[model samples]
Target: MKKRINNHQRSTIKKVMNYIRRYWGYLGMSIVLAAVTVALTLYLPVLTGRAVDLILEKGVVDFAGILAILKKMAVIILLTAAAQWIMNACNNKITYNIIRDIRKEAFEKIERLPLKYIDGHSCGEIVSRVIADVDQFADGLLMGFTQFFTGIVTILGTLIFMLTISVKITVAVVVITPVSLLVASFIAKKTFSMFKLQSETRGEQTAFIEEMIGNQKVVQAFSHEDEALEKFDEINGRLQKCSLRAIFFSSITNPATRFVNSLVYAVVGVVGAFTAIAGGISVGQLSALLSYANQYTKPFNEISGVVTELQNALACAARVFELMEEPSEVPDAPDAVNLEEADGHVALEHVSFSYVPEQKLIEDFNLSVKPGQRVAIVGPTGCGKTTLINLLMRFYDTNSGTIRVSGVPVNDMTRKSLRNNYGMVLQETWLRSGTIRDNIVMGKPDATDEEVIAAAKASHAHSFIKRLPHGYDTVMAEDGGNLSQGQKQLLCITRVMLCLPPMLILDEATSSIDTRTEIKIQEAFAKMMKGRTSFIVAHRLSTIQEADIILVMKDGHIIEQGRHEELLAKKGFYANLYESQFVNTSSQA
Candidate 1:
C-alpha cells in the first residue's frame, strides 16, 4: 500500500510541492481570496431571501436595509474578485519565471551532459522533455492547484450553507456529489494512462520531425522523403488512437456529472414544496434553498471536471520531473579543481577509451607533446584519430588513462576553465547567419578591427573577404552558403586564429579545399603553428612534412611513430601508406 501510494505521488506531486513551497505566499493569497469569494457568493442568496421575506410580511420592505444588504454583498464580491485576480496575476508571473528557469536549466544541463547521453537520446526525445513536457507541466502548475482548491472550497462552503438551511434538502443534494465524484475519479484513473501514452507518442513524432529537419540535406541526397513520410504517418496513426482513448474517458465525466446534478435538482424541488406547505420553511426560504442547491451542484460539476484535468496534468508533470531527476551526464567530482594557468602542453598517458563497451577504440594510448610543438596525426578511417583528439580536448573522458595539461589532470579542471584555453578548426565549418566580421570576431568578441584583419591575413582569408560586396561587413548567408567550401574553411581558420590560444587542434581542417587553396592554407597554417602546441589530424601526407613528429594509427592503436623522413625509410605502416599514396599519384599522372 505504501509502494502504491508512493507511485501515485511520484514526479508530479514532488514537482508541484517544490513550486508550491517556493510560492506559498501567492498561493495563500489566492486561497484567501477564493474563500472570501465563496463566502460572498453563498451569502448573496440568503440576503435576497431576507429582502423577499421582509417585503411579503410587512407589505412594504425597508428600502435602506435592502439596499444596504445588496451594497454590502456587491462590495464583498467585487473585493473578492479583485483580490483573486491580483493573486492569479502574481501566480502567472511566478509560473513564467519558473518555466524560464526550468528551460534554461535543462539547456545548461544538456550542454554539460556527456556525448553518450546526447547520442543515446534522440533530438526529438530531448526536445520533448524540454519543450512539450515542461510546457504541459507549467500550464498545469499555473492553474491546476488554484482552480482545484477553489472548486473544493466552493463545494464545501455551499454544502455547509445548505445543511444549515434544511437537513432533508441538503441530504438530497449531498448524495449526488459523492456519486458524481466516484464516477469522475474512476474515469480519470482510467484516462490518466492514456494521456501519458498520447504524450509519449507525440514525443516520438516530434523527435522524428526534429531528426528529419536537422538532416534535410541527407534526406534529399538519399531520396528517402516518401519513406520518411510513410513512417511519420504510421506514428501519427498511433498518436491518434491514444488521443481518442484519452478523450473518450474524459467525455464520461461531464454528462455523468450533469445527470447526477439533474436528479438532485428534482429532489430539491419536491422536498422544498412540501417544506413550504407545512410551515417548516417560508416561500423565500424554499426559493433561497433552491438557488443554493443550484449553486452547490455547479461546483460539484466543476470539481468533477477539475479532477479529470488534474489527473492528465499530473501525468505531464510526472514526465517532466522524471527528466529533471535524471542523473547528470558529467557531474563534478568531489575533488574537482579549477584550472588557473593554461600553457597548452597536452599529454595523454595510457588513455584507453571506447564509445561502445564491446570495442576498445584506444587501448593504452600514450602520447606527450612539448609546449609549442606542432604534431601531426594521420590514420585510416575509424582508426581512433578523432577519438584521440576528442580525448585530448576532454570531450570524452578516457576509460583507463589520464589526460593532462601541464601536469594537471583534465578531469580535475572545470570545463569552462579548460575549454577557454584552446582553439579548434573542424572539418565541417559551421557559420551562423551573420556578417563576416561577426563570424571572425566570435572567437574573441573584444577583438578590434585591426586584430580581426590581422587574424584574417594570417589565415590567408583577408584577400577574398575584402573582395566581397560589403567587404569585412558582408553578411554570411545561412550555413555560409554564399561562400565557397574553401572560403568557409578559411573563415573558420581565421576565427580560430583570432583566439590566439596557446593550443590548437585542426581536424581535417583543409581537406575540403582545392589544391590551390590547400597550398595557400598550408602557408597560413605553418605561420599559425609557430610557437603553438598544435595537433593536426591530416589526411594528405604533404601536410605532415614540417611536423616535428608524425604518428601513424591503424585500427585503434598507434602502429608507427617518428619524424616524417624517418618514417618513410622504415618500410612499416607509415612507409606502406606513403608508397600507396605515391602509386595512386603516379597512376593518376
Candidate 2:
C-alpha cells in the first residue's frame, strides 16, 4: 500500500524536492549563485565597521582610499544582484517546463481511460485534477524550493559572518534558532493536516457545484432549489472551516519567529553594553554584529514562513499524486496487436458482464452479427441494451465470454485501432462549446466543409442548421444549450455519419426527437445504415420492424429473437407488447 501524505504543505515540499532532482543543473546553479549573493550582502556591513573604526581612531582619514573602497563595494553589489536575478529566472524556467509536462501527461492519460473511469468521476473533478493539481505543483516549486534555497543560503552566510565578528553574539543568536524551528515544525505539522482537510473539502464543493449545474433542468423540474442550496451550503461551510484553520496556523509562523528573534536581540544588546563599557569590543564591531544578526534572523524568519506555505503545497501535491496513481482502465497489454480494416462482423459468445461487482446485468449472452447486417435491440428500461453496446466497444470487459470483431478478440487489439473501426452516437448527445461546423467535424477532424455539410444533410440537420444566425459557423454554448434536444441528437447523428465507419452503434438516437423530426431522422438513419453492420436500441417497436434481425430483450436475455412477422405470428412477448401499445391508443381515443 502506498502512503498518502494528504497534507498540502508536506506534499508540496516533497514535490519541490523531487523537481530539484529532476532539474538538478538549474537547482545547483541557483543555490550557488544565491549563496554568493548572500555572502556579499553579509560582507558589506562588516566592511562598514572597518571604515567607521578607521575614521574615528586615525584622526587623519584617507579620502582617496575611502572613495576606492566605496566604488569596489558598489560594483560587487551590482554584480551579485544580477547573479541572483539570473538564478531566479532559471528556477522559474525549469519549474514552468516541469508543470507543462505534468499537465500534458495527465491529459493524455485521461484520453486513454476507459468509459467506466469517465462514468465514475465527474467532469469537474477530472478537470480539477489536471488543471488545479498541476498548478499546485508549480506554486509549490516557487515557494518550497527557490525562495527556500535563497533564504537558507543567506541565513547560513550571515551566521558565519556574525561568528567571525563575535563568537558570544553568534552563540546567542544560534540558541534562539533551534527553539524557533521547533515551534515552526510543530505548527507546520498541524498546518499540513489542516491543508489536507481544506483540499478535500474544496474537491467536494467543486463536485457539488458541477453536479447541480449539470442537472439544473432536472432540479428545476423537480422543484429542488432549496434542497440544492442546502447541500451546496453544507459543502461551502466545510470548505470555509478547513480553510480558516489552515490559514490560522500559517499566520502564527512569522509572529513566532519574530518573538524568538526579539528575545535574542535583547540578550545581545545587554552583552554589547557590558563589552563596550569594559573596552572588550568597539562600537563599530558591535554595530556590524547587530546588522549581521538582523540579516541572519531575517532569513530564518523567511524560512519559517516558507515552511508553512510548503506544508500546504505538499498537501495539494499528495492529492495530485493520488490522481496520477489511479489505475488506468485502458492500460495496454504487452505486444497488443493493431486492428486493421475490419470486415464489419461482431460476436459475443457466452458473455457475462456487470457494471459493478455483485450487480450482474448480463449472463451467458450470445450474439453474432454478420457483415453488413443490421440488428435492432428492443427492451424495457434496464434490460442491458446499452450494456451490450458497451461490451462490443470494449468499454467494459466481459467476465466470462469472448467478444470478437472481425474474428479478433477485442482485448487483443490496440484500443485506438479497435475504436477506429466503429462510430457511435450516444443516447445523450454531447456538444462542445463551438460552432456547428466544429461539432460535426469532431467525428472526423480532417473532414472538409463540404463533407460536414453533406453529413448534416444526411442526418436531416442541414435545413435547421441553415436557419441559424450564422449557419455552420454559429457557435453554441456549453452542451449546445442554444439547440433543442432533438437538434442536438441530430447533430450527433451527423457527427457519426461523417466518420463513415464500417460499424455503427446508435443508443436511443431518435428518443429525443418529435414525431416529425423522428420521421426525417429515421429516413436519414436508413440511408446511413445501408450495407453497414449496425446495432440500434429502440423504445419504439415500429423503428425495429424493418430490421434484418430483431432481438426483444428482458432481464439481460433475448426473450424473443426473429424477424418482425415471425415474432408476431408466435403471439409471444413481442406480440403482447404490440397489442399493449394499441390498447393504450384506444384508451386515449
Backbone clashes in each candidate structure, one number apiece? Answer: 1, 16
Off by over 4 Å in 2: 1-16, 54-73, 333-335
| TM-score of model 2 vs. true structure | 0.92
lDDT of each: 0.82, 0.82
Clashes of 2: 16
Give TM per candidate.
0.89, 0.92
What digit string (tens of lDDT, one per residue) describes model 2 on residues 454-493?
Answer: 8988888999999999999999999999999989999999
**Per-residue lDDT of 317-403 in model 1, one digit per residue for the tens?**
666666666677576577777776577687888888999999768898888889889889998999998888778777788789799
Give the clashing pairs for model 1: 124-207
Off by over 4 Å in 1: 1-9, 51-77, 329-344, 431-438, 463-488, 575-582, 585-589
Candidate 2 lDDT score at position 173: 78
The 10-residue segment with the lowest total lDDT in model 2: 1-10
TM-score of predicted model 1? 0.89
